[model samples]
Target chain A: MPHRPALTPLVESLPATVPFVGPEAQERSRGRPFRARIGANENGFGPSPRVAAAIAEAAPESWKYCDPENHDLRAALAAQLGVGMENIVVDGGIDILLGVTVRQYVEPGAAVVTSLGAYPTFNYHVAGFGGRLVTVPYDGGDRESLDGLVDAVKREGAPLVYLSNPDNPMGTWWEADDVVRFIDALPETTMLVLDEAYGETAPASALPPLDVTRPNVLRMRTFSKAYALAGLRCGYAIGERETIRAFEKVRNHFGMSRLAQVAALAALHDQAHLADIVTRVAACRDRIAGIAAENGLVALPSATNFVAIDCGGDGDFALKAMEALVADGIFVRKPMAPGLDRCIRVSVGPEAEIALFAEALPPALAAARGG
Target chain B: MPHRPALTPLVESLPATVPFVGPEAQERSRGRPFRARIGANENGFGPSPRVAAAIAEAAPESWKYCDPENHDLRAALAAQLGVGMENIVVDGGIDILLGVTVRQYVEPGAAVVTSLGAYPTFNYHVAGFGGRLVTVPYDGGDRESLDGLVDAVKREGAPLVYLSNPDNPMGTWWEADDVVRFIDALPETTMLVLDEAYGETAPASALPPLDVTRPNVLRMRTFSKAYALAGLRCGYAIGERETIRAFEKVRNHFGMSRLAQVAALAALHDQAHLADIVTRVAACRDRIAGIAAENGLVALPSATNFVAIDCGGDGDFALKAMEALVADGIFVRKPMAPGLDRCIRVSVGPEAEIALFAEALPPALAAARGG
Candidate 1:
């Protein structure tokens, strides 16, 4: 190949990879849409009617650029969260926030700690910023090993650490007090990104109170899960006043679409709709667990919108089962990392989707077992 | 004061600032909306009716995430531009692309080059990434000094350079051949970001053909300009496949909202609407120039939706004039950097809005002069 313009030495050395692909790509590849849209943990229950109405109403007004300050939404969020306006900074989602936080802290070659198979998007940003990853294996309970992460952070002297509570894939969570202890133990020099993207569906016991007094922790929450606003892409971070203000340094000023702000603001005000979705998600998880028990398998306890069920075999068996489900037009995903790979991840959805999963799992497992 | 968490050295060292206070925020502070909203260079004509209809249709589907690959839009763009899909990367807008490009090339402490009073957002990104900025003053002429920029890049061994053709703030453009020479003259180790955001409005002779085969030059285009989709925030970069593919290493996979994709695709197909808007914009630009002449001021020739009128005084006089116009409920802005500060920027709008500007300028000028 002829010589070409080079990426910065750091970017050039990085791998060419993506953390995840949306289910739309999979459907396109399949040349057909799935019968059950319960994959990727998107709110198949959908956003509230009010949210959709707000979107439609605001569609024409989109000719004007979104206010870069995001004043109205931020003020609304402050009022709702009982925090001051300066305590919050909103963006497209926590994904963008993670990228920003990494830039704010990790210099190239700086150490950063995360779980072994935690949120891959976070890892992507860490590597993109040339931060070295110091990943700890999940605790045997399939929860992020907070103590191990703290140890690694101190050992590596990492400037940034990431954890997703009520975790994804496995859906296990650390309790509030354990989380508080973990926060207290961390060095002030290391910033903790507590991504509670699934916070809405999680039990109150799993969530610590949002206190802006702590400068070391940035709490990230999203409307993508229970609010059914995944397509809207609105998320925000809460931190001490100065830390929250720091996001303004590098955020794309006009990045958020005007309609997204409207959709998110409307969603926040519809607590009844959120409560309904959370109840539906919880019931769906229980129904999925019961279905797993009927099949003589085990479903992991979950605090999120998904359930991970063990196939009572190996990763290979789970892989075949997942593939069989896809072939049966029941879209679902499985963890590819070693220990986590024994389970197939199924998202909690409406009865129609959960029923489809129940109908397909038996035949899919038979195919996986070649019975 | 309590010691809350500290920002990273780079972030703390940066100022708490925004490039511009949004017009909406200004209106809120002033307790009323602007009568003629022609300040932010937005297309007052708005998006195509078809695009608005498409957004309305897609609003309900906001429950699902947009395709992370942006496959359909990329395929259509590739077919339109005679480039392969592998040669294109789409993002929120040119501002986001500039920031990502800066991150891809400039390491902390490395030099990057741009015109002193050019796009402040690009400079914001450079600082966000800790790249030391090396600014070249515009030549005595209003246009950016291309020769001076090239000289500075070579002298500083800067890894990245930015040049907005039909440049923002001034609205001047260079012909395709001159731009081609600029690309060819850059070092193989350096990257050039050619922002052709206003390409739809500029004369065809001014734009180089899309050249995705060039590894170092990435031409950024947007739907925000003549396409009239600013609020949607869709933009793309065209470059060699090798360079373009690297964006996969570090982008918010699910960041592009579903509405943005459908709206852009619809706008792209409605070329007649775009052409109509361009004609309307040109006519308005000429009218604006005439209005400026009537007021005994000079209107810099504009190939953009906005024109800068030389106030024939210092920066303070121009600023005072802009403030007075705002007081008259006509939203307008002025360039703030030293050499460019003597001009007030006004966006082209409908006839009524133009008349509003015509009626407001002389009185505002008189008031400003008296003050």
Candidate 2:
């Protein structure tokens, strides 16, 4: 560390960490691939054939850079969402958009509010930007506390707040009416990042109507979940014209991948494919819940592509069960927060993966119980 | 603008602008595609067939998120560059890396240095981060002035300096020894961002050997140039372990596209394809120079995929010629700084594009002169 160029004081104080370790890293560490890849909430159902064809067609044209304005993809998203082009801004993924939004609104030591254990990537961005984060605990045992979030925002005078509908890990969601109530309660100056990454798989009741007149709320959607383009990295935010324009000021202008744009546009055109994947995801969620029942565990109600099964024990027991599953070549995840840590999180996938998880669940639970 | 969330002071002061418009945008505005797509320094030769095949193969697997660590690609780049895996970090592109670098080291009003008209994207990042930019004019009109950069860094006590060898816009380069001399001249506290985005197209003598032991130097290379994977958006930075580790603190951990990783890995494995492209680019460079000579203009020597033809006039004349070429369905660019603005840049492409330029130049020059 002798005479090296210095990092900013804020960056120097932060730890070098990735919010999530991808399944690829886990497999490499274990020296083998998992039999069931039902983790990280990816759509194992895969993208539509037309999307794949578009990607292949765009392959040779990869010599040219992507459109920095994200013109074509934005246009398609606007048309489909019944919003004007100025209401949308596209980026590599929701994660990048989160980072950009954090940078745009959160200054050093500025207060920001979110659920205590919701979306670690968002938290990472807040820390990266030196924002003071005020977290509200989950309401009851699973859902994000909407009332608590609003209270904290007002109390802390936070300028930014994040809420992910159809919550991850526990996979619970609030109804559209409750969401509208939360939005109506928020202060005019506080920006609400309503991340609906799982919007495609959730019931239509879980989402409010697309409204771009409100400048305080920015709704995030992704092609990663139901569209199966996680590896391609395409997501967009819909907000009022002026609020969406703020993203253009701080985002990496040339950051979007060109083939990603093509894949997303093609996916948008294939609504039949999306409808099929949504049906499949819902069925898989039911299947995963049934598997939990067979293992003598309770599965929470879920509107997302994953199910969280209570191990009927403490955090340590759930962690042990999840680790056992991983050791048995079945990839899974679990929440680490106190109340949310009583369950293992498993993503919805194809039958083969679901069958493998069903086969491994009992043994993993047995190992956790040492029975 | 009523009741909208307030942007950060820094972001509020910035403009919503794309650093460089993609050729796609130009085509959309012109209502037709360019006949000679020889602008933006893209590799018109396209990626290797193996790379295209790999992209097609990976298309269906886009359901999974990219490895947050970017492990495999970093390992491959490490082996190729003769550095440890810890010495390398991968991102979407050089533009993203530049943004991350600015975030890591620059605080508001902190000084950063670069050639006056080197890369607009870098300047964009610096501005986004609220850094005070100290620009050094290009030496004797073309090459980045290494000594002048040192003077500015010392005078302003700048923490970061950027120099792109085999540089963009001007198609100029500095010898390895001169580069090493510049490195030795800078204070250890001042980081040098040695952008080698065009390294693959340059002569071997123009690039210094990869050295990752220095804590202040970060060398950036991209697949966007010789490897013809610009649309895939992959770039890497090689540096000392400590310097490289700082990137993890501020980077979007899972931002790298999986298809981009696949395309770059395939490109690296196909050296013969890269060599072929290099040879083709060299020949096209010569052809472009011949076209310039025919038009009674001098072509600047280039160790890059593009040649800059000196129109032997002022900036306005060069701008008029470039616009005329664009109007004629021949996409070309030019440097916009004071001294460098006399040259219009033409990227190396297939013979058809070169021939198109050859046919378009005389008439465009005549129109420019008359206008």
Candidate 3:
């Protein structure tokens, strides 16, 4: 065999598996498009029209590289969050930021903590950096166990911990006071990466006020959710100035797209559109719950743009239902972790797509039951 | 001071410095925009109109995340490059791919080699990953020294080496046969990151045929140059199948902006526009050379989108001229390295911007001469 350069042992040991297989890949393999594209928890209602207009306007100026400082978008976020611009570091998305954060904090064989079935992308980053992941199972209520995470951090002396409020896979959440209590309980040296990607869709009470005084907490927010600019790939982390400054040491500063900045700024400016989206998302949740009830399933209370419906059976049953729905061209997803796997997750979209999901559910349920 | 989480020792050791300060940062500091935006080697002729149309058409679909696999874009690239789809890995840009490559190949303190004044972003990544960089000086002709780089790689036993053909900041190139010889001379254990971001603007004879059989060589190309989609943040790497597969082990799969894929695919389909841009860039390079001659400066032969004009003095003199040009609203930059710093680099742009540069050059040169 010809000699070849060897990958660092850490990277070589990593499994070449993606965290999520996107619906587009499914479409390619299936040889047909999903009639309802709602599997990825994307804001299928789409970005504000103003954002589209801004993107169209900026398209002609696509030659310019993005501002490395991300000054304008960070300034806008600072104003909106009532924090200093230095407290924010905007990047491609929460996904890319997670990798950066991991690189900053994780050394080889270092421990990192997260919920068992939390965002797989975060787990991917931890593994990519060779961090030993110590997972805490979700509580009986399907919420991330704050006490468990604190205990794991103390036990492993983990440098980083991840928590996604208004959680993924299972849409349960903790109110601000409880979250604050959890924060107070963590070891001071343990950094908490509080992902609030779904923040805009959740109730205000579920979010704690910005606390830039704490050096260990980094709260990440994105335009991808209720802002409906997922494709724009813009996200920001709010933290103490020095904590945010650490990003500058390792970030690909010019990695952001110029149009991402323009689209995010326009989306942020349209508060009226955001409010409308939130309202529509709440209504869609109820509609999905109603559809679940019609199918003899239970829908979990959700503070996010997506609803997780318990299929009144087991993980295998939910998987069967999800596959049936996918086969019928109604794109939907299910949680795969043991306890959470009984549920199928569906994101809220425009009425037309949701109506398609509603129409496809009964047959999908029948197929799952082999009736 | 309150207790806080600490950055890893490696990250703490790294300084918080950006690889290159963007022109936008300068504009913000100066409280005005430049008349000629040609400093960063961005293709100011802009992307194909077809790409803009594609972006506008796809703007409403901004809610969807990019296809994590980058299937369609990679397929197109593979078809164009005469390689299997598995031989390609697409990411945010060449900047990001550099970081990923460094992370994959360089262990902490591993030696990495590059031309002394070559791409700083690659150096930034090496430092960020705790790799010790070994620099090789350019030859007397001001081209990257292939023999010197080979010597440095052998001397340092460097795991990774970076080469940007039709190089940046100097805009000089070596012919294809020489590049192939350089590649052949390297030990197979040392990976060569061949950055061909300027490849599209160079003569076909300047680029070697794609040879995906070599696991030690990764050839990176981007839409940021000739295709003029820098704002889209789309670039790809071509390598042997297993080598390319290694990227999937660590990359942020969904980090690419959805519209970026649309824009790049559309840009690739418009070869006629790319050909037109290449022709225009050549003419503009000649125009810049003519302007430099009129100003009593020597314009270096360039095979890229930018030309470097020697100010016929030392580094300090070139710095003064570049500053004067910047003050006059002509955004030009100069090399800061020892031998290379005697020149100011200017990118090709529309006639209006070039005219602005032309008008500003005489006063800038006079200012440099203490007029």
How much TM-score does chain B earn in each model? 0.98, 0.99, 0.99
Error in Å for residue A237 of model 2 = 0.1
lDDT of 2 by residue, B127-221 (tens): 99999999999998988999999999999999999999998888889999999999999999999999999999999999998888899999999
Per-residue lDDT over B63-119 for candidate 3, one digit per residue giving the tens place of the 0 to 100 score: 999999999999999898899999999999999999999999999989999988899
Per residue, candidate 3 scores C-alpha lDDT tens digits across A68-101 of 9999999998898899999999999999889999
| lDDT head-to-head 1 vs 3, winner | 3
Model 2 lDDT at residue B371:
100
DockQ of each: 0.65, 0.85, 0.85
Candidate that beats the other on DockQ, 1 or 2, i.e. the better one: 2
Candidate 3, which segments miss by more than 4 Å at Cα? none
**lDDT, residue B309, model 1:** 96
Candidate 1 local lDDT, B80-196, one digit each (tens): 899999998998888888988987888889999999899998999898878999999886747888888899999998989999998898887888898888888888778999988
Clashes (candidate 1):
0
Q: What are the clash counts of all predictions, listed in order? A: 0, 0, 0
True contacts kept of 2: 0.90
